[model samples]
Target: DVVGLDGAWVNDFAKQGAIADLSALMTEHDYDDSQLASQVEVDGSTYMVPAVNFVYPLYTNDALLADAGVDAPPSNRTEFADAARAITEAGDAAGTAMPLSLETPSGVQNQVMSWLWASGGSMLKDGKPDLTNDGVTETIEYFDDLYQDGVFAPGAFTMKEQDMVEEFTNGRVGMMVDSLAHLTMIRESNPDLKFSISALPAEDGYDGKRGIPYASWGLGVSESSDHKEEAWKLFEFLMSEDANAELASMAKAFPGNVASVPDFVEDDELMSQAFDIYQAGYPANEFTGLPVAEDLMRQMNEQFQAMLEGDITVDDMLETTQESWSAEF
Candidate 1:
């Protein structure tokens, strides 16, 4: 059985004929795709079910905020920077903790792009890379300044998401943005850590609107599977409402089955906020699951890393990114 692959793998797998098209199985089994919040579709065919969807939110260490005399998390980009600086001073953030943890290359890429989207732009528009959008340019400049001002931890460009999570939970980061999947682990790692989750701050004049990147892991059957019928039976059974409810409860993730949602949603403040963000968010990138898209993303990341090291100016980075995109697409 083809299973437990990243959502981005769907398109390439289908192109290689390594995974069977799930459209017929979906219909034959009376599976309703619309009930799920995210679906993996390549061209006109369904390739994977939405097994577990994840979204990122700004996580604030409430204790750190209180120590910094910050009354609340910043609601806009202008205030976000100010808050970072204030926390840095009031809490001796440079020595005690990072005012913010912008995990590099990987998380930093998403962190910046979320800003781009919040500013009403996209990396891809109309089936092509559009990294030169004004919003995108502004986001890069914003981060360039933020990083130069020492808002993020030193050596952050060398840190990954896991590293940021470790710092945040260890009381070494005043704030960080990360996925819900990390929440349970964070709580378990440090139950006494006072933290709160909120949507990413938007640029001033953005009316508090922000964009979240959504991803999911779902099931797919291998084309070479001889026991296709039996494999599907297992897949279908797991996708059932009862099974989904159980799965959601265990994983602390949203279930694909609409009927199973309340099992994880009700009385859960974090999950409820997550659902709201999900309602307002978009897929991380439209180019995802496409062959050349990964290369494009890597090139973008490399440019971003260069910007962090003062090796590339923001304008130069964007110019290079656009050239790469133009060449690729």
Candidate 2:
């Protein structure tokens, strides 16, 4: 049986206004926060329940770092580049070394958004989208520098989520930002490898800004599903502190619920090593969630690529960004 449910289908349905709610067809069912995302707000009520939550996280090839003579995880953007440069310069990788491999489409968007957050970008003000600030420009400039300098994998523009993970696992790339769920796969494939996780680094010397792409993966119920009752039962179970912990433990990903991190996971050294990051994590939700105001991030990816590749000037990028988001946001 095919679910026939996805963003493409949803968007098409939304266009024709043909999507229907099946909640009435199914009896009442209960689900937790984990299942919440499968259902979305419809007339102020939930519709479908999700079974699992996927999170975007960073995975580094510590082996590569060591071979390149890097003593520890990069402390800042400069250090990050230095490590990547060292690995590539030492001839570890053929002519290509991806210091940063952004795999998931959503993950790519989040990575760019983090730059805005880290650089004091004002995405929301008084609960509305506000892109009129300096942060957005500053972040775009930074990303432009990264891409123009050839720090990222050339194929990053078209990489699938799983393929990105395989890049790091197969020793092709030095770092990867992908689903936290794959940590288990990585552990199994390379038991002796050293890896670490923490908040993504913000712009260099931006002490006030800490980089985080929260809302990695969350459960939401679908409003069109008939099996909502049974789904909700599973949803609630998934969001349970018990279930969340087990998933986080098994997936090696951070927990969505701030109160529900699993015990099996070790403490985050990145947060411990850097106070700005720790403080950022503490007040991390400053602009949490992809609020309706912020607009869907897919457009951000398109604009960033254009901005980075010289297809559009920075001002052009800004103009297009404003135009793209002006109406909906």
The digit string of per-residue lDDT tens for model 2 on 15-59 reads 343443434423333223342223432333322222233434455
Instruction: Give the worst 10-residue stretch by lDDT in candidate 2.
Output: 94-103
**Candidate 1: where are CA atoms >4 Å away?**
23-31, 94-105, 118-120, 207-210, 226-237, 262-264, 279-287, 292-295, 326-329
Clashing pairs in 1: none
Query: Model 2 shows how many backbone clashes?
Result: 22
Instruction: Say which candidate scores most in TM-score.
Output: 1
Clashes of each: 0, 22
lDDT of 1 at 229: 89
Task: Tell how far residue 184 is off in model 1, in angstroms.
Answer: 2.2
Error of 1 at 199 (Å): 1.3
Please give the CA lDDT of all the candidate structures. Answer: 0.70, 0.52
| CA RMSD, predictions in order | 3.6, 6.6
Model 1: per-residue Cα lDDT over 30-140, one tens digit each: 877666655566766777776666677778888778787778877678877877776677754531122223222345345567667655567766556677778888888
Per-prediction TM-score? 0.83, 0.65
